[model samples]
Target: MRKNLFHNLALTLSLASSSFLASYPTRSNAEGIMSSSPITVVVAEFINESDANWWKEKYKSSFKNMLTNALSNTGNFTILEEDEEAIDRMTKKRSLGIIPGFGGSKKEDDSLQAKYIIKGYLSEYTENEISESTQVDFGAFGGGRMKQMFGKMGMNASPGGTQKSIKEVDLTFNVVVINPRTKVRAFTRTIQGSAKEEFLSEDVDMGFVKSQKKVENKFPIKRAVMQAMEESGKYLNCVLYLQDDCIDEMDAKEAARQAGNDAMDLF
Candidate 1:
């Protein structure tokens, strides 16, 4: 009877351990293996015009090409080439409701034949000028008495103030991502930075004289956009799905390490 009870207990514990291990999520290689699938993604047209007058239409094509190339480099998804007529037909069918959209219906998930779709908006791209100013006051006072009988020379005091200006460029970018099937937002992020320019002005006795500096292409705006996109890509891959498991594992490892240290403290 004692042996049988011990055997049952051991079996139960073994089974429980197996169940826990099976349920624990392993690190995913989906990102590394994205290229092996027949997934077709539609890179939506981006709207790059932010302020009405400052539109650079050439940037629209440049941005689109950059995005396409970046996504292809991930080796996870096969981007539909521009010349694929079948993809065009599929796009039209989905648009006309002849076939369900890429993310529309679970029932059509197998039939739609595409794993995922990507859509984005270049919500904001603008350059702003920021300036800081400071003021300082200068004064001189002098008084002298020459002769004992008569105070000869005397001088009054006068104070004057001057102001100076410093200017910098502030760039901003906002991005958004959506799941094509459910029309739900998957990720969003913003990037902003300020860059200082060389100031040529100096304070003079007649106030201050400075030349108007032209805004050169400093690439701060492009750098901010690229950073935002990179962040969005990481969020899409690991944050949305695997973050919880990774966090739990980290917590468990930390706890075990602490417990081991506490035990060793007794020595």
Candidate 2:
């Protein structure tokens, strides 16, 4: 009886050791390979020109705010705040450190040392014209003795009693992304749109109406900017080998175990 018991214990120990070794290799530590470092991104001040004039400080400030908001929405990288003092210091350092044939190294001017930097220019133009149209209509009157009445609706009236006017505007945006250190452009894309307005009132002059129309046209600009950023973010993530939360690790392990069991015909 004692010999039989000893043989059974040895067999159990051997089987357990073999199972552990087969399931997990000695170097299979998943934690060490996962990265938790956050990437930094910087936005340079945008320059805008309209017709022959550049926007003043106020408009430039507004544009910067818009750009910052768009970038933050991407949720892919940390955006660095612009520090004028730090930027000046870095620029001076770069100028002093430049070597011959090095092309005046200005990489240090990019304060963020970001994986990517985005810069762009925007230009907008708008125009409006006054025009007139003539139309014919038919109506009947039945409240007077052989009385005839004729009237015309104003230019604002449509066939459906709804007033609509057509206004148009042009928008153009150009965006470029570059690697700060190498100065190599990673991406460059431009998008433009011509938008037509459906509502304009004669009570408001063409200038006021067209101004409103231009505001409405900004919708397309916002959409284009978002699309460009999304594409850029995809490229950045690819370069970094970014891992997003697609599935839980535990769930994946359970799936693998089930698959292995099915393959081995061991339900």
Candidate 3:
């Protein structure tokens, strides 16, 4: 009876472990073999259509990596490693530098075949900077008596206010998911993100020249790109798993964003 009881307890623990693990999806191994259901996806090299000279081809590849990482973080998709050399050669072979078949090759083995090929292109990018300075002269406000009192307190009494500088960056990009076998577009989305940074420094205008301290490496553009990609990842997660609640949340957020944009345009 003791031996039977121990066997029963072991069986119960084994079943409990299986039940707990069953709630989570099985991940693919390095060979790209999924033990269970997981959508396999590949991120193609992104295209840079922006007119900015600093937006180089390497940056496009970097964006592709960002999207790949975003999708991989969802835990519902099997993200495949793309062949950069093959994609670059294919892009160069084409006249417009656009890869045909969206970077999917027929020679790819069945084990590594991706069901979805994610593509992206940057359409618009803009960065604007503005600086404003306020002239403050106590002498102009009051008279010589007030200016003399402030001067005795170690104040220059010239333009001694603050200089403020604002930098804003806007980025717009499109993501498309295509079925490799059918060569048809499965989903397409346009994502836009904007970021702003401000710098305030003590300024003194000596009437001939002005000096102000400025900050460095604010990276507003990088923040904008990261924000857009975060949204893109959530959207892809909803699409792949058919999560209705996530879809509704994304729609509501997008509607609110559009409304905000309209309100801004009215100004």
Candidate 4:
């Protein structure tokens, strides 16, 4: 079952990502003219601290590719092929160059056009099984002895067969966009999403019987991660460029402009 579900995760990913993320604002000048320069961005594969090595190895490409592809799909950014060694060097060298008395500068950064590096990590990547439950009245099965014992103890005895169980799966991650030049974390967010499958057994009364015998999973971890990425990608541009606050202003202005144009059409 694990192998079968793992193979089907790709299909779920496409279905999950069908809806594109939020609107992205174009960089503009003082004249409000949009800048044509494509924002350059680089992506690094997310780190996995989850003890699931198989999971990390399975979905590493999805984690990295989704970020870059999400940006590119906006048609406002250029995804740059970056060298891992060069990026590591820049990070270490940048930290070293900042001195209290001196200044902060890096020669390599001067030539680099990419302004943002998308970083991410998996906080949790696991799935668990769930069981449906219903309460059964043991009084119908003639439990007068239990009632008498409870009555002596001044306690009302309810049906011991009354049981309830639930199960669910979750995928969560922390994503950040950073500016290498200033060593600033531009945008930081944590996204948690889940994909639940149909109930294995609709008979609530019997669902919990031997529940632990078989673990039922609705979807693979990759699907849940993909679902999370799709949602987080919505705020990518806003966080990277600090456009979250001003997006509302821009939309209102555009709406007013349209209203004025409609009024003039009456002339």
Candidate 5:
């Protein structure tokens, strides 16, 4: 009865799951942040040097979105360059002396605006993938007749073999907070994160050769990038306006990581 139940469960799960084609972002061990009053800033395009060719062509916009979302989580800064046309109109109006509030709604004071800019450079990203597959020619669990033969031949059987794809990942990135008004680099640092996972399959059909098609989840790069972004907010304060309350790279990174954890449920 239990065997039948297990089989039904396996079949049900398989039917419900989709093929591993993409990976979504999760909170990196590094944390995230929240701003005090929405400090205004312009976010420059992040320079990508991570050697990920596919991501460069297709997912660049997603990377930008991740940054925008992460920065928004920090209560301190409000993004200004998000709407280029609005900023351009404001600039043109100032030059024409048409003033935003006097002619428009006096409530639309343009003076309380973006105060800083944020920039990021993806300096280093390395995904070293190694796959090992062992053929299972014996019983599904490899413990029936196959076990007896291996044991008599002085070989250890059932080496804790798993029908799961194992993967490891490591990532690094650097970011800078700039005060456009002062033309100063307020703060900059490189942050890193890494993770490994084994995707276990309950279906006995997931033996050896079946595992090859599951490479996409082996090294989840996009997820890694998202995690790095979450914790990057820690140092913005020291660079933006938290001068004396500033933290060193290690402290800032830790703060960012913890802050990310605190903010996870909001999304």
Candidate 6:
């Protein structure tokens, strides 16, 4: 009788579990209810239309890869690399029977379908350097009492003190989000990043030989572009996920940027 009672209890629990699972057929766990699979997106190669003379075509792929990494960090989309030439080659191979298909199907039916496409264009990229030289004159007639004391000792000279160079880099990208089904550009915006670095060097002047070698300031182009791509990813995530808080914050930042620009325009 004890064994029978245990069997009956097991059967009852099984039936209850089955009923609960049937009622929620789409999910088997609580976590499944909170999140869904990431949406698939294709990121196209970035185009460089900027005024920078050093921009190369191969850098477009690098920019696309950076953007891909940025979007992947958001954990919202399954990013796919878009390559038209590779796709064309694959298609030709498949037609020539070099690539096999499942179930003898001639066409690729289980291919990846993207819900959205991201396009980027480098609209503006510039690097500017400003350098200033400082010197001290110790001429007796031209300078102060301190200069007169130094001049009396035969030290009448204009010695170069320091040279300061400030280099600034600005990068801007125009990003567009397109709906694959509707073929419409759903969102278009510009993302920008700027970086500046200051360098100081002493100008040494020996009596016989003068040597002033100016070291090139390594502009942080990758840093600026990566930051811009990160912002683009977050903005895309906000729009794609319909996150109100992120959207509000982005809007507020844009408004503040515009206000600051307007304020600068007064000068």
Q: Could you give candidate 5's per-residue lDDT for residues 1-267 as a string of tens digits? A: 999999999988776664332243235312333333657666666677877554564344566567778777766666654443444444444445564357554323353255555677777666654555554444345548776776576554444333556576767777876554455676677776667666554322322322223333536766777777776665564556343435565576568866875797588
TM-score of each candidate? 0.43, 0.44, 0.64, 0.52, 0.52, 0.68
Q: In model 2, what are the clashing residue pairs, if there are any?
A: none
Q: Write the per-residue lDDT of candidate 1 for residues 1-267, one digit (tens) a residue.
A: 999999999999999999998887565643432333534555554565355244476766555555666666655445654423443444454545554545455544333454344444565444555444443322221322222212222211111223333444444444455444444566554433344444333333322332233333443455555655554444334333344454455456447746865897899
Top of the candidates by TM-score = 6
Ten-residue stretch with the least lDDT total in model 6: 103-112
Candidate 4 clashing pairs, residues 3+ apart or interchain: 130-167
Please give, for residues 1-267, the per-residue lDDT of candidate 6 as tens digits: 999999999999999999997887563453343236787777888888888887888988898998899888878788755486533433344445442344333333222346667889999888999999887555544447766665575554555577898888998899998765455698887888888888888765533445566666678787888889989988887777545567789888778867876997899
Q: Residues 206-238, candidate 4, lDDT per residue (tens digit)?
A: 323322223455356556766777766656654
lDDT of each: 0.48, 0.49, 0.73, 0.61, 0.58, 0.73
lDDT comparing candidate 5 with the true structure: 0.58
Candidate 3 residue spans exceeding 4 A from truth: 1-36, 84-107, 110-112, 136-161, 205-212, 255-267
lDDT of 2 by residue, 83-146 (tens): 4454444334444554323543454434535555666666554444343433322332254321
lDDT by residue for model 3 (23-48), tens: 76555333333224768777888888
| Candidate 1 ranges beyond 4 A from true positions | 1-39, 83-89, 95-114, 131-219, 239-267
Worst ten in a row by lDDT for model 3: 90-99
Q: lDDT for model 4, on a 0 to 1 scale?
A: 0.61
Relative to the true structure, candidate 2 reaches a TM of 0.44
TM-score of 4: 0.52
